[model samples]
Each structure stands twice: as C-alpha cells, then as structure tokens.
Target: MRLDGTVALVTGASSGIGAAASVSLARQGAAVAVVARRRERLDELAARIRGDGGDVLVIEADITQEAQAVEAVERTASELGRIDTLVNNAGVMLLGPAAGAPMTEWQRMVEINVLGLLYCAHAALPYLLKAAGAGPRHVADMVNVSSVAGRVPRSGSSVYNLTKHGVGAFSEALRQEVGQKHVRISLVEPGAVETELAGHNRPEVLETIRARFGGIERMQPEDIADAITYIVTRPRHVAVNELLIRPTEQE
Candidate 1:
C-alpha cells in the first residue's frame, strides 16, 4: 500500500477525518491538496506535511459553492500535476426532531453533504479518469465518508439520514459507471467517531446523543483515516469498494 508519485485531494480538511486523512496520505508518498473553508487550519496542516518531507497544497474553498469546488479541482490538477485520489469527507450532522426541525438546517446539510460532494465529484471525475489511465498507479480512487445513519433510519435524524443515504446511492451507481474506466469509487460508513460533527447539532439533540452513546467509546479521526488510506493505497488491481467501520462496543 504505497502511493509514491501520486496526488490526492481531500475536502473538508480543516479538521477531523479530512485532516487526519490528509496527513496519512502524505506519509504514504502522495502529494496532498487539503481543501476546506478555513485557511488558517489548512496552513497549519500544510506546514506539518512539509515538515515531514511530504508535498502538500492548501486549497481554501467552500465546497457548497459549485464554482469554488470546480476551481479547487482545476488548481490541484494544474499545481499538483494530477489527482489520483479524492476523499469527499466534508459534511455536517445537524440532528433534531423532523416535525420542528429548522428548514435552514436541512438546507445546510443538503448543500454541503449532498450538493457539495456532488460538485467535487463532478469536477474531479475527468481528472480521476485521466489519472487512472496515465498516472504512475494506473488507478484512481474516490472515497465518500458517510455515516451508519445512512444505512439505518431513526427518529429525529430524518433529514440527516436522507443526505447520507443519498451519498451511498450515488457512490454505488458511480462505481458501476466508472469501474471500466479504472476509477474506483468507494463508500466509508463510520458508526461513531469523535469529531466536530456532533458539535453542530442542537443542545437537545446533543443530550440525546450523549444519553444513547454515553457508555460506548467513540472512535477517533485517525481510525477512519487508516481505513481511507487503506483504500487508496491498495494495489491498482484491488479495489476495496465499501467499508463500514464501527467501534466494537457500538451498536
């Protein structure tokens, strides 16, 4: 599992899984472009990658905006040379009861979790296809980070589940569409990880989350990072299409 001479673009990279995945991929010898809305965090991440003797590019863009997402892909292709892997990890988890939930929260989730992921994938597909054909590895990878909620529907998380379920559907369909092109599309569904995702929810929702998972130890960002790194660094002929990871105690 080596990525020598390849380039990867990771979105939602200011922190959490995106940040960890960026560092992990860089260590494996890929020039990584870290994309997020926050510039300072990206700068910090870039310095760490450089200090460790890895090539990295910092791309500050709000992926929910279609134009910015397209520009990010173009800049990476022009600057980093070629994109061999794309990790669509930027997302939000705004959970609450469906009946009284704010429409704004639902809109925000759709904008980033669904539309934003779509924007990046659309812009990167051409490059990924080309990279699979001509790059050192002869294969390109795209990993979409979803949640277990994508698989199981529950009360109070109606819209959040809807967005993540959409991710799963799109990934499988695109995987079949691009399999012949050698562009690997994978979906990673994490059960529970300690990240800023939970912090975005309302206080009442937070209480419910805590009460439910209070006894279970949550996984960390690096856990998912390792899974992502595993996917992209596989032998070109081996494609790990789907991975569902969870803490041993999670149910």
Candidate 2:
C-alpha cells in the first residue's frame, strides 16, 4: 500500500474530505497537488502538509471552468511528474424542494458536482493512463466522491440526487472503459458526514434536516478519507469499484 514516488491530484482540497484525503495520500508517500478555489485555505493546507515532510502543491482554480481544470491537471503533471491518481472530490450539495426551489441552487450543483468532476477527469485521464503503464505500481486510480443520495432519492434533494446518480453512472462506465488498462476508477458514496455541505442549504431545509437525523452521529471527513486511501492503495490486480460509507447510526 506504500505509494512512494507516486503523484496524486485532489480537487476540492480546501477543506473536509478533500483536505483529509490529500494529507492521507501524502502520508502514504505520494506527492499531492491540492485543488480548490480558496487560495488561503489551500495555502494553510499546504503548510500543514509540508510541516509533516510531505510534498504538496496548491492550485487555486475554479474547476467548474473547463480551461482551468485542464490547466490544473497539466500544471500538476508538469510540476510533480505524471499523475498516478486523481481524486475527483470537488462538489456541492444544495438540498431543497424541486418545486419553487431556487434555480440557481440547482444550477450551482450541476456546475460543481457534475461538470467540475467531469472536467478534471477528462483532463487527467491521459496522464493517469500513461502512469498506469510506466509506474512500479502498474496502476492508476480515479476516485469519484458521490453521496448516499446518489443511491437513494428524497423529496427535498431531487437535483442533488440527479447529480450524484450521474456521478455513479459515469464512474461505472469509465471504470469499464479503463479497467483493461489498469486505470482503476471507483465511486465513493458517503452518508451524513459533518462538513460544510449542509451549511449551503436554506434555513427551512436545515430545520427539516435537523429534525430528522441531527441526533445521529455523523462521520468525520477523515473517515471518508480513510476509505479513499484504502481504495487507492490496493494491489495492482485489485480494484475497489465502489464503496458506500455511512456512520453506524446513519440508517
């Protein structure tokens, strides 16, 4: 599982799951490039990783933009050598009713959760493939972070559901396409992690969410990071195709 000499690029790395995953991968000996829009947060994360003797690069770019996404990937490969792993973790969840819901919220979700992930994956695929062929590990990993809502639909989260479902579908198809080349593509669906995702919702929606599962313990970002690390560190012949992670009491 040691990833010494490998290079990885993680999106949405300003905080939460992306941040934790970047640290985890670095700890496992991968030089990591952390991508997000918040430059200050990214600088803070880079400092922390560097303090621990890990190599990191901070790229402050809005991945929703295709050109920025492509540049992010190209710069990472140029600066850190080939990208052996890509974590498509940039996403937003604006949960609300479909009827009378702010169209902007839906649009934002599609832009970040769907288009952002796609752009990063598309740009990184060639580098990942090249890495799979040359590395001592003989494999590359692309881990897409979705949500449990990707698997199950709820009334207030219709569009959120749509985006996550699309992630799952795309991951499966891409996995099939690249499996023979040893570029392992995986989907990670999480439930009720304590992150800033819920803060993006409306006050009314937050109240309803609190009324339902607020008492239940939510998983930490590091918990999901652990799942991601496990997926990428597997042996060359192994592929952890999909993992649905939830707190013990999330049901």
Candidate 3:
C-alpha cells in the first residue's frame, strides 16, 4: 500500500482519468503499465511518464477481449516482475433512453464497461495475491472506478448505470473474498468529472450534455487520480474500501 516500488497496471490509460491516475501512480514510485486500444495514445502517456523519470510500460490492447486482457497482465508481470496494484478504469458511457438506444451501443457499453473490468481483474488476481504476501508493502490493491450513477440512476442513463452498479457490487464482493488474503479491493465513485466520456454520446446529445457541464466547475481527471492515489498509498492495515468524490458545486 505504500506504492513505492509497486507495479501498477492501469487500463483505459489512453486518456482521461486512467491516464491521470497512471501518471500519479508513477509519481509515487510505482512502475506503471498503461493499457488501452490506442497504441499511439499509450505511447504518448508512456513518454510523458518516462520524461518525468517514471518507469512505465505501454500495452496497446482492447481490454474487452479476454485474450488481450490476459496478455496485458502477463506482459506487465513479465516485464515489471510483479503486480501490486490494478486500476480497472476502462469503461464506456453511451447514454440514451433504452427504448430507442442503438443495440450496438448498448452491447459495446456492456462489453467495455462491465466485461472489460472483469477480464483485467481475472488476469491480475494471481499476481496480486503473490505480491500481497511477498512484497514489502504487505498488501496488494485493486481500484475499480465506478460512477455516481452506480448509486443513483438517471432517466437517460439506464445501461451506463447498470454497468457502474455492477462494478460497485463486484468490488464489494471481491473485497470480502480477498481481504483475508491481504489483497484490498476498493471502488472509487466519481460524479461528473470533465473528461472525454461524454464524447462517446451521439453528437447532438453530447453537445447538450457538454453545455450542462460547461457552466459548472466539474472535477478534473486529476482530481479522481488524486483520490485513487490516496487509496493505494495508505498503510497496509488501512484499507479505504470505498470513496465517493464529487465537485463541490455539482449536485
């Protein structure tokens, strides 16, 4: 939990909160593996981290694919030698009324947001357990990123809410199962951070939602990154199980 010399694998590291969290973890002395579908973006993030004298690896693969997710964790352990932390930050939000929403978008959200997190967690668990008992930190940690929608669903966000809620539930169960093994599972629920998540929406709807956040001082991605850092850097006996962060001005 100290984060010094820890090996962290962060999914969705191409941009937004994941990218920010990777940088934050790297700054704390963890060797970070950045995973995402965009090779170029991953490279960019890796370069930035390296420029700051942080150890980093760029693994370009779509986490929704089971094989890629497994390969990603394997490669991280092979290259970095061990895995102490996992940040399951890869997710999608295609918000619309379910009745008229495109089936493809719904499936895509489920695949990337729900199944993707599971794939990464499945692959990372073994290494996490190994590190938990062997490393100086004495505990391994998994941080699953959820949304405020996980707790409170809105009319236009049914599927997005479902995926996030599932993440919250999964984190709770995993925590109960893994806590005895010295592996900590935590969930970070963020409310309306200013990020590229909304760009996945249909153009018109994206514009409308953009305007809604445009007036309010929404949280930055780094804000969520800071929350993640706080959780992972705690002492071994202190497991911050769940954290909900929202911008002060936002409802």
* Residue pairs in candidate 3 whose N, alpha carbon or C atoms collide under 3 angstroms: none
Cα lDDT of model 3 overall?
0.92
Model 3 C-alpha lDDT per residue in residues 1-251, reported as the tens digit of each score = 44777899999999999999999999999999999999999999999999999999999999989999999999999999999999999998888777877899989989998999999999999999999999769899999999988899888889899999999999999999999999999999999898889888998778777776777899999999999999999888889999999888777
Pairs with steric clashes in candidate 1: none
**Pairs in steric clash, model 2:** none
Question: What TM-score does structure 2 among the candidates reach?
Answer: 0.99
User: Candidate 1 on 128-208: residue-level lDDT in tens?
Assistant: 999999969899999999999899998888999999999999999999999888999999999899888888888999999
Report the Cα lDDT for residue 75, model 2.
Answer: 97
Q: Which stretches of model 2 miss by more than 4 angstroms?
A: none
List TM-scores for all candidates, in order: 0.98, 0.99, 0.97
Residue 219 accuracy (lDDT) in model 1? 96
| Clash count list over all predictions | 0, 0, 0
Instruction: Score candidate 1 by lDDT.
Output: 0.95
Candidate 1: Cα lDDT at 141: 96
Q: Give the CA lDDT, 0 to 100, for residue 161 in model 1.
A: 97
Candidate 2 per-residue lDDT, tens place, 1-251, comes to 79999999999999999999999999999999999999999999999999999999999999999999999999999999889999999999888778899999999999999999999999999999999999769999999999999999988889999999999999999999999999999999999999887887899998888877799999999999999999999999999999999889987
Off by over 4 Å in 3: none
